[model samples]
Target: MKKQLLRRIGLLFFLFAFANAKGQSLYEIVFEASDITYKAFLVYFNEQDAYMRIGYTYKGKYNVVDVKYQSVTGQEDGYNYLVMVGSNPRFITNQEKGQSYNPDHFIWVWNDQNPNQLPYVTDDPNFDASHLIQCKSYIEIDPKTMTDSYLRQFFRTDEPEYQALRKMRDASAGAINYNTSDNNSNSGSSSNNNNNNTGSGKSKMHLLLVINTDIGDIGQSCAVDQKAMEVEFREIAKAVGMPFEKYIINGEKFTRDNVERTIKSMQVGNNDVVIFYYSGHGFRWSNQTDKYPQLDMRYSEYTPLTEKTSLPLSAAAKAITDKGGRLNIILSDCCNSDIGRNQMTSTTFMASRSFQGAEIQKLKKLFIDSRGSIMITGSSPGEYSWCNINGGFFTLSFIQALKEEIGYMRTGAPSWEHIAENAVRSTQYKAKNCNGCKPQNPVSAVRVSQR
Candidate 1:
């Protein structure tokens, strides 16, 4: 089956290239609202190639010539004869002349006996002529007079007929006309130069995953965060249609310098969705500053109090702001040691840390003031972020939320706010079930003005 398909494809390409080289005038006979109701039938004719490609909307899917050398013979009586190319796999290995041939040397004979009967081809009772009975428009196209842009518009634009079919065709072919290479790069130079968005017209959303599993204080062999998070991260990214660059930092590798370098490597575009996710140990300084509250990066060369081991959370907001990203999100599945930041003044905060607290309010203020981004944390201040053999509870919950929230999206991708709501709910549920685990409620600082 594959061989036959490839052979037909090769023949089509050869025909197109050959006709173009010979300066042959290619004409397309288009019928609007013809046999295919509310759709268009485009038949291409090349005198040099003596072949035509029949493009049709069949069963709501656009299929253009799956077979080769289908004949369309027009007679002097203004009637046309068609012999559909047979779909057989053996034609690939066997190039016998009988596969396609002119019937009866283009002979035409009139038998007066068929005057009271329908055409022999339409004798099949299953054939439906209800749609074929109407003819809307019959137009001929000259490829020479039409610019490439005009030709594309003539076939694709002008109405709902061919517009949908053209889009379907482009999507089925992996959107080869669009450049998606920039999605892979982490460097600033790889930012998209093309002004156009993706084929779906949605802004390009990029993700940066930072997983730091091993805390040197906890034996390296015992740390299992990297493997656990990566599995779910990939699944979530695939479902959301977002491409990501991942960094797995373990043991002494999770240093402030390394984190800064990774953060600096990213370049977000103005019309892009940028997300940064970190899963590991985290802590706020005992003397936290409002301008730059630092989170301790677990397991590095520096001691606990040293600046080399601490990462400023503001850096993330700054990086995203520097690139003028439209939507920015930061997720930290880690713990903070400062209780001052996590003030439980409200009954809601005391009951469930996931509820709005001083910590969340401060973070919200920080982000809105800095870059108008959103922040989600796995646990409230002074609470430990729990993890089992599978992975961090918060990360797994976030992934689960993504699956559910993304499923609900009728069109395009889910908003970050929706995802955060689901994640917090799911995380609270997961934390409730774990025995001996403190009630860990994930919290978020969302800024609606950014949207």
Candidate 2:
């Protein structure tokens, strides 16, 4: 059945391709209602190449195509048949003698033969000739008149539908300001700061990874937000001087083998900061109950976990402290991420102190004596991390704050304190505006180097 369905779909595609090949001269007309400016363009396929002819529709005429070829231009005589009859029409005529022309052009066509067609063109059976309008235009080329090629529009009107369509097209053509930079410095600093910071090793290297384990068990809004956070963080890291080696794993391209490989390749030194972030489902071992209780770390209903999916936080902390690095910044976006209670119950004190279960400590740190470790988290124990699909509240504000407008508010380059403050502010704002979700709580802690 599946094979038959695939064959049918393939056949339909071939038929549609053939239909498009037959009617290749149809063009698109665009008009702006406000300015009363109009454009008409023909998109067609010849041989295997698709071409377009664009012109303006002025005073009920189109004057667009600029070139013309005589009959004796090519090797073929009248047999050439003027394959294309428009201004600036591109002609491609390479096909086998008996083969039909098939060019790559997308168009929609309707077949009136079958009334109960399962797949009909336009996807509407009620649409008929009355709903469609057709118009014709001419192309003129006169060398004596000094007009190379142009289209003569036959019909120019101010119909309601036409006007409405033109208005929509004009609105769509308008530019949107996706880059919300308040001043000129923000736009210029992205490149300029990168150049200045190229050789400056003043700040310690930090890799923060946040993973939300709540997704593995319960449905949480933070799962999707956590993914977006990782993407933004990676972009920020690239904008700064961090390599791909120093990244917090949050299922971006993470697998068991890749995770192990990343952990094994860690370098610990004075200037290196390694961060691990998790935001999904997390659980704490309950001694009295002798089972793990599902922590409400998400805005949705309470859901419990049977086993712990996240690495023990104590083990992770011990890994950075034992390596004697200048700084280690551990940032987690997960809720109820504390592993203190579970760590004390499950492992011996000596084993817990060592970086046995902790995977982030394997990096080779490369820093001097003047840096300290920083750990930032989305939420603390018994708190929920909120997320909305529209955007990551914490991350969006954090990035904006580091941007020129907010960063320039202070005297120097953005510090971790500034970024954290911005993230918290943004998260709170989003929580208040969001309908169903609770406020997101972000936490930060730093461990300085004694050396």
Candidate 3:
């Protein structure tokens, strides 16, 4: 059944790319309003730009290709939608051909109330002709959080997830032009001076994943968030063929002491790549000075919120930096608001994918090739970091941007600075576009160099 489904994924058809997900992301979505199950491939050029190859089947045999390749961030709700503004639905059967209109837009919604619910399109069916039958623009589609396994299923053959990553990059840069094998070979064969990495030289990198998923208020959401990070961080290592040592602190062992002990005692290669990711409640202390938020290390709702329960992001960065790893990255996806909102230092850091491929060269541009100390957060010091059941908006956006940097979304030198910029912009859009949500401008500090 899966292979048959894969066979039907005709080229040049529109796709959701699993909801502005990672670069070269592909997803098959079913809307509550239509019988047609849509397959989509979304590749982010940047947060403000994306290409969609919208496709659906006619009578379960023919593929409908309506490619509307444009940026579809939810202007109405930040990062919760893909507004394909057109009235034409392809009711035809053809092989790898163009449509009268681009039908590349697909809708995905986050089931905020029921976290376990698979994404069922929530767009109302009673809209005008301009909108697809039941496809509305408010459903949240988190393309950035998809696991590599589901991604692998999209190709009919047993293509490696990384290989698909390349095809998607190429398909994205050359929308409707998925057959760029010759060009890819040429590019792969060519020398790339920018990717001459100076890191620890293919040794085991280090990834530290810390999550407060068992904490009271947002525990459920945090669990999913933690899982996504695990998948993503591992995929990063796989994409670049980097051997890695992973350290995780969560559940009953989640405490400030554990994180501190782990970091202070952990041994990383002097030139290794180390990344620290944190997900949970975060805030600023009344007397704090840094722009990043502190980790809410408490593992249970009954735990007291005090100095013992928290770890500042800066301290973590400095600790990681002190280890002398060649390339270091720390990301905190909690709020930066004052501690308890009554200006207790207030509350919210408020905020907000993956792959492999020959575009593997592109991956080198950001991962294997760069050097520096980098840190980013989901929101500014005073705003609330927003999230639903899917994950933190900031984390999802970071994945999206990472995919963009490695995908064939652009040409020339791949850049860490560009990836950081896209992360901030994408998270900002998700916050700014929401109805009750306040605007969130993420904060990032980077001191990295790429040749």
Candidate 4:
């Protein structure tokens, strides 16, 4: 009976020892960044001579990492490093010598929330990737109740894992430095870019002018002042450093194919800006559930409108966006009423005044660096974009806003948002209050997709 009792006790002890040695949790480590949290497990296995393994789940797959030490140095042996394998190996650090291992000193890869933001990198040696994180993003370790002392006790300061971790950290830092340099070259400095031809620290601006002076019918006709509006647009483009090309479609030349060709030929890049100007008639086609805007390119005689005779505004916008223009401005000075006919009216108003030489100089001095598309319409849907002997109210206000200095010139060029707001307000005030003028309302829309 005594021998049997002793045998039972020995069996229990052996089973417990084996289970503990097979898979022991040494530490559950947490690394935090601004937008992501990486949870790593420091696991000890007796089968491999008590070697430590890092286990983590990435993209929903379990990754078991075998890291070799790269370095561990400090008066109190504070630094500990271990690295996985790859050309751009991910990093895991316990602490750095003579420095507190705070969450703030974390390497930020990229913003997970922002789909457009790419990783920022640099090539500067001694450059730390930790500073890449913005204040809003952060990482946190799990098992919050775990003691810090218990975690620190598992550190092997003299092991190969320490040195390997250091190597991983350096590699990540270099990648960050490289990314930073690349973004700066493309976005912040014109001299570093080959696409910015003039080295004026400004991206090239291209303008395509489309004017329709002869819509044929008297009611659907723009005043003779349409020519004056075109000239004003040319001057505004010159003042704003745009090399513009104008195309007038009055009779048979006005067609969807021609307009599509013009848009396709723009070939805008990340360092290029495009302005599409259309002055004529805007048509709205309705089929119960939908109402779409189209630019009418009517011939001299009254004829039924066909697909070849007009271009859909949506189609034009899609072409511009698809062409990858960094900044796209669409200015349409036309009637947007859905009545299937253009408003015919002659105004005594002449072309509105243009900006002064000094104002133009101020615009030339300003540098705008932004990406996205903004559309400024002459009038809202169901309203007539009034054109007088002076000019179209919408175009006039747009030009005036470009000329006026909202802030200091050196701070940077006026944002599309600022310009659009100013133009919309100015046009509304002038159109509603002007004598013998029909009520007109300007409409503006913006899409900042890839700034």
Identify the leading candidate in terms of lDDT.
3
- Give me the candidate number with maximum TM-score: 3
- Per-prediction TM-score, please? 0.44, 0.38, 0.63, 0.47
Runs of candidate 2 with Cα error greater than 4 angstroms are 1-265, 283-308, 337-370, 391-406, 447-451
Per-structure clash totals for the candidates = 0, 36, 48, 40
Decoy 1 TM-score against native? 0.44
- Window of ten residues with lowest summed lDDT in model 3: 183-192
Give the alpha carbon lDDT tens digit for every residue of 18-114 in model 4: 4433211133445444334444433321111122333344445444444421110111112111111111122243323442221111111212343
Candidate 1 stretches greater than 4 Å from native: 1-205, 216-244, 247-251, 289-294, 300-302, 338-372, 408-414, 448-451
lDDT of each residue in 166-270, candidate 2, tens digit only: 332333344221122222111000111222122224333444444433333322344444444454433343334344333444333323333444555566544
**Prediction RMSDs, each to the true structure:** 23.3, 22.1, 12.5, 25.7
List the global CA lDDT of all models: 0.42, 0.34, 0.58, 0.45
In terms of TM-score, which candidate is stronger, 2 or 3? 3
